[model samples]
Target: MKLKCLVIDDDPMICDLVKHFCSKLEEIEYCLSANTGNDGLQVLSQQKFDVLLLDYHLPDMTGQSILEIRSQNIPVIMITSEKDFAALAFDYDEIVDFLVKPLHFDRFKKAINRVHHGDSNSKSILQDDNDICYIKDGNKYVKVNYNDIHFLRSEENYVAFVLHDKTILSLIPLKNVEALLPSHFKRVHRSFIVNLNKVEKTTLEEITIGSRQIPISQKYKKEFFEILNNKLL
Candidate 1:
C-alpha cells in the first residue's frame, strides 16, 4: 500500500532531500508540500494524506500549533534540527516519531514503515488463529504465518526464517526483523531468534524445538534465561 505524504518545511533543500528520500521508497508517494505551518494547514484542509513529514519550527507557526488545531488521526514524523523538542513531540498523539535533522536513510525507512502499519504495536496481525507477517520475495511481497516458522537465523546481510516445510529469506537485517516479530518470538542469540511457543525443551546453551536445536549465545543467554524462567513458572 502506498501512503500519501505531505512535507512541511521552510528550507527548500530539506524539501528536496525529503522528496529524494521518498522517491526511493515503494511505500510512500510524495503528495504535497508547504513552507509554513499555516500553508500546511491550508493544504491539509483541501486534501488528505496518510502521513505527514512535518518540520518542528515554521516561520508563521510551529508544527505543534497545526497539530493542536487539526485532527489527531494522521500519523506524523516530526523532523527538527533541535534535539530539545523530542520531549515535546510525543505530547501530540498524532506524532509517531521524532527525527533529528540529517536523517539516516535506514531510520527514515523505519519511521515510514511504522506509519505504514498504522503505528500498531500489537503482538501480531492475527487472523483465523494464525499470526502473519510480510516478506519481500523479489519484487513481490509474500505473507508468511508465524506458526509455520521454526527459527530465524542471521546470514550476513539477510535473515532466513526456517519453517517446518519451507524456509523464507528476507533481505532485511536481523535487528529489523526482530522488531517485526511478535512477543512470543525471542532472540536467544545475536544470530538466532526462536518461537518461544514452539519450544519443546530448553537448556542453558540451547533451545530444542521439534527435533531441531537452536543455540543460545552468551550475549543474550542471561536475559533469555530470565524470560524463559518466568514463562516456565
Candidate 2:
C-alpha cells in the first residue's frame, strides 16, 4: 500500500526536497507540506498521514515542543541541522529515526521503509499500530492515547474523552467514536462508553475509574453487567 506522508519544515525548498525524495520511492502516493508547527498541526487534523518528515525548529514552534503536547501515532522522521536534540527526540516513541539535515536519500528511504512495514517501536497492539486518534480540537488535532481514555461521555453533538486530568471535547458523536474503539470499550449507557480495563470499581448503576464515576443507563445495564460478570475472577 502507498503511504501518505507529510513534511513540515519552515524552509519551502526543504519541503520541495522532501517531496522530490518521496517521489523516488513508489510507495509514497501522497505527500503534503507545511511551513510552521501550527500550520502543520492544521494539516494533520485534516488528513491522516503514515509518515511525518519534521524539522527541529520553526517560527511558530519547535518540532519537539509539538510532540511533547500532542502525541501522533504516525512514525516521525526528524531531519534537522542540529545534533543536540537526538537524545531528547528519541524519548518520543513515535519518532522513528533522527537524521541530520542535508539528508541523504539512503537514510530518508530507510525511514520511509520503517513506516511502510509498521515497524515503529511505539506501535500499539490493542488497536491499530498507531493506537492513537486525533481529536479535532478547534483548528488543530489533539492526539489522545486510546489507553489513556478512561471513558467517553456524549454531549449532544460532541463527545468528551474523560482522562485522568482533563476532558477533551471532540466533534465526533459517541457512537462514531465507539465504532473506532476496540473490544475493551463497552457501552454501558447511551451517553457513556467505559474502557473496561480502566474500570477500578463497579456497581449496578455506575462504574468508577480513577476518581470519577460514570453512570450506567438502565436500558443497557442488564447486558453490561452480564459482560462484566463474565470477566470477574
Candidate 3:
C-alpha cells in the first residue's frame, strides 16, 4: 500500500527536500509539510496519515512533547541534526527510525522501509518489549508499569491512568486509549477500565482496586463476571 506522509520541520528546505525524496518513491503516495509543531498538530487532527516525519526541535515545542499528546497509531520517523537526541527520541513507542540532518535518499528509504515492515531500529524505553507505558505527568513522561495501573478512569475529555501512588491525566478519549491497552484491561463501565491483575474484590455491582470502587454497569456486568468466574479457584 502507498503510504501518506507528513513532514513536520522548522526548516522549510528540509521539508522541501523530504517532499522531493518522497516523490521519487512509488511507496509514498503523497507528502505534506508543516513548518512548526502547532501547525503540524493542527493538520494531524484534521487528517489521517500513515506515517509522520518529525523534527526533533520545533519553535513551539520539542518533538518529545508532541509525542505525548499525539495519537498512538501513527508510525514516526524522527529527524534531527543532533545525534544525542536519538536515545531520548527512541524512548517513545511511535518512533520507527532516527535520521540525522542533511538527509540522503538512501537513508530516508531505509527509514521508510522500517515503517512499511513494522519495525523499529530500537525498542521503546516506555514499552521495553513489555506491558509498560510512559504517561504524561506535567511536563515530563513518567514510566508506569502495566501491573501498577489499578484502573483507568474517564474525566471529561481526559483519561486518568491510576497507579498506586498517583494518577496521570492525558487529554485523550478513554476509548482511544482503550484500543492501545492489553487484553487484561476490561471495560467495566463507560467511565472505567480495570486491570484484572490488580483487582482485589469483585461484586455484581462494583470492582475494588485498592481504595477505588469502580462501578460495573449492566451492559458489561455479564462478560466481566464471566471472565472472573473462569479465574475463580
Candidate 4:
C-alpha cells in the first residue's frame, strides 16, 4: 500500500529532511508538511494520512496535545530531541515509534518501516531467542524470560505483557508479540494470549492464570481445549 505522510514541525529543515527521506522510499506516495499544530490539525481534518511524523514541541502546542485532540486513528512517529518524552509517547495508542532527533536516514527508515509493519505479513522486528525476548519499553529494552510471561493483552496498538510482578507495555500489536513468543504461548481469545505453561486451571469459558480468568472465545476454544486436553494425564 502507498503511504501518505504528514510531517508536522516548526523547523522547515526538519520537514524538508523528512520529505527527502520519504522520497527515497518507493512505498511513500507523498510527504506533506505543516509548520504549526493548528495548521496540522486543519490539514488532518481535510485529508487522511497513513502516518504522522510529529515534532514534540511545536510553536503553538506540544505533540501530546495533538494526540489528545486528534480524532483519527493515524499512527504517529514522534520526533524529538528529548529522551524523557519517550516514556510519555508510548502512553498514547497512536504513537507507533519514537525517534530522537539528529535523525539519521537509517533510523528514519526504521520508523517508517514500523508504520508499514502494522501489516500481518511484515517480519517481526523484536529480538528473541530460545529463552527470552527483548521488549521495547520507553527508552529502554527490558529482557523478559519467556517463562515469566503469564499472558499478553491487546490494547489497540499496544500490547501489555503481564509478568509475575508487573506489566510492560510495548508499542506493538499482539500478533507481532505472538510471533516473538515461545511455543507454550497460545491465543485463547481475540484480545488475550496465554502461556500454556502458566495456566493453573480452565473452565468451559475461561482460562485461569494466577488471579485472572481470561475468556476462551469460541473461535479459539476447540484448539485451546485440544492442546489442554493432550496434557492431561
Candidate 5:
C-alpha cells in the first residue's frame, strides 16, 4: 500500500518542493497539505496519515506541540533550518527523522526509506512471541531478550540496559528505546525504564525489581497506576 503523507509548512514554496520530491516515490502518496499548525491539526483530525512532514516553526504552534497532541503511531519528520535543534527533536521519540532546510532529494528519500524499513521491522517484531528486541550498538546490532533485562537506566545520550548477568549499553537515545519497548515495560522515572514483568512489587514512591528498588517519578504516577491496575485486574 502507498504510504499516505501530510506536508505541513507555512511556506508555499517549501511545501511545493516537498510535494514535488515525494511525487517521485512510487510508495508515497501526498494526502494533505496545510499552511499552519492549526490547519494541520484539523487535517489530522479528519484523516489518517502514515507519515507527517512537519515544519518546526509554525504561526500558531510548534511542530513539537502538534506532534504531542497527534497520535504516536504516525511517524513525523521535522523540517527545519535550525540544525542545532536536532538533539531536541530526539527527545520526542515519535520523530522518526529530521530534514534540514534546502533538503536534498536523495537525503530526503533515504530518511523516508529508513522510517519505512523501521516501521516494517517493528510490525514483524510485534507479531513474534519472543521477547527480544535487536538494537544497534556501535557498529553492530545486538538482540536483548526480556528475561535477560534486569532494569534500564538512562544516561545523557545512551541507556544502560543492565541484564540479569551482563550489561549492554546501546548508543540509541533513551527516549527512542522507550518508544520501541512493549507495553509490559514502564517508565517509572525520568531516567529509568522498568519491565513490568520483572517488577516484584510497588510502594508509594518506589517499585521493587528483584533486589533493586527504583523510584517512580510523580510525572508518571498516572501511567504507573494504570499499569498496576491492569495487572491486578
Candidate 6:
C-alpha cells in the first residue's frame, strides 16, 4: 500500500526536497505540505495520513505541540537541524524517528522504511477497523466498539470514555483521542465528546446520548447545531 504522507516545514526548499524524494518511492505518496503547525493541523483534521514529516520549529506552534494534541497511530518523523531535541523527541512514543536537517536521502528512505515495516516502539491505539478503539487501562488494553461509546468526558489529565455498558478511562488526553475518532463524534463541549451515532435527541440546551444528557458549549452552539442538523438531514 502506498503510504499517504504529510510534510510540515517552514522551509520551502526542504518541503520540496522531501516531496521530491517521496515521489520516487513507489510505496510512499506525498499527500500535502504545510508551512506552519496550525496549517498542518488543518490538513490533519480534514484527511487521514499514514506518516508525517514534522519540523521542530514553526511560526505558529512547535511540532511537539502538534503531536501532543493529535496522537494517532501514524508515525511522525521529526525533521529538524537541532540535535539537542533528539532525546526529547524519543520521549514521545508517537515520534518514530528523528532526522537531522540537510537530511540524506538514504536516511530519509530508511526512516520511511521503519514506519512501513512497523518498527516503532509505541503501538498505536488506532486499529484498522473504524468501529473499535483499544485504550490502555492499567496493565491491559481494552477494546471498545464505537457504537458502545456514548460520550467522552475529560478530567484534568485523563478522559473517560463512557460506553453504553460502562466507562473506560485512559491516561491519554481527550484531544488526542478526539482527533482519531470519525466525524460521527463531535465535541459538544470543551469537556465532552459525544458520538453522533449514539445521540438520541438534542434540545436547544442539551444533547441526549443514550440515557445521558450532555450540555453544549455556548461558543460552539451554532456549529454544533449545524452539524446535528446536517447529520439528521
What is candidate 2's lDDT per residue for 47-104, written digit by digit as tens? 8888888898899999987777644677788878865455456656787666677777
Model 5: per-residue Cα lDDT over 120-175, one tens digit each? 32211111123645444544445567767777888886778877776677665567
- Native-to-model Cα distance after best TM-score fit, residue 52 in candidate 1, in Å: 0.8
Q: Each candidate's TM vs. the true structure? A: 0.56, 0.50, 0.54, 0.56, 0.52, 0.51
| Residue-level lDDT for 123 in candidate 5 | 19
Weakest lDDT window of 10 consecutive positions for candidate 6: 120-129
- In order, candidate lDDTs are 0.75, 0.76, 0.80, 0.82, 0.74, 0.77
**RMSD, every candidate, angstroms:** 14.1, 12.0, 11.1, 9.5, 15.1, 15.1
Q: Write the per-residue lDDT of candidate 1 for residues 101-155, one digit (tens) a residue.
A: 8776766776788888864431122111126454554444445778788899899
Error of 5 at 164 (Å): 34
Q: Which stretches of candidate 4 lie over 4 Å from their true place?
A: 119-233
Q: Give, for candidate 2, the lowest lDDT window spanning 10 residues.
A: 120-129
Comparing 1 and 5 on TM-score, the stronger one:
1
Candidate 5: how large is its RMSD? 15.1
> How far does residue 232 in candidate 4 sit from its true spot (Å)?
50
Q: List the residue pairs that clash in candidate 5.
A: none
Among these predictions, the greatest lDDT belongs to 4
Name the weakest run of 10 consecutive residues (lDDT summed) in model 3: 120-129
Task: Report how far residue 166 has shifted in candidate 3, in Å.
Answer: 0.8
lDDT of 5 at 187: 83
Predicted candidate 3 versus true structure: per-residue lDDT over 122-145, tens digit per residue: 222123224556565544556677
User: Of 2 and 5, which scores higher on TM-score?
Assistant: 5
Task: Put down candidate 4 lDDT per residue, 157-209, tens digits, no spaces.
Answer: 88899999999987878887676566789998989999999999999999889
Please say which candidate is ahead in TM-score: 3 or 6. 3
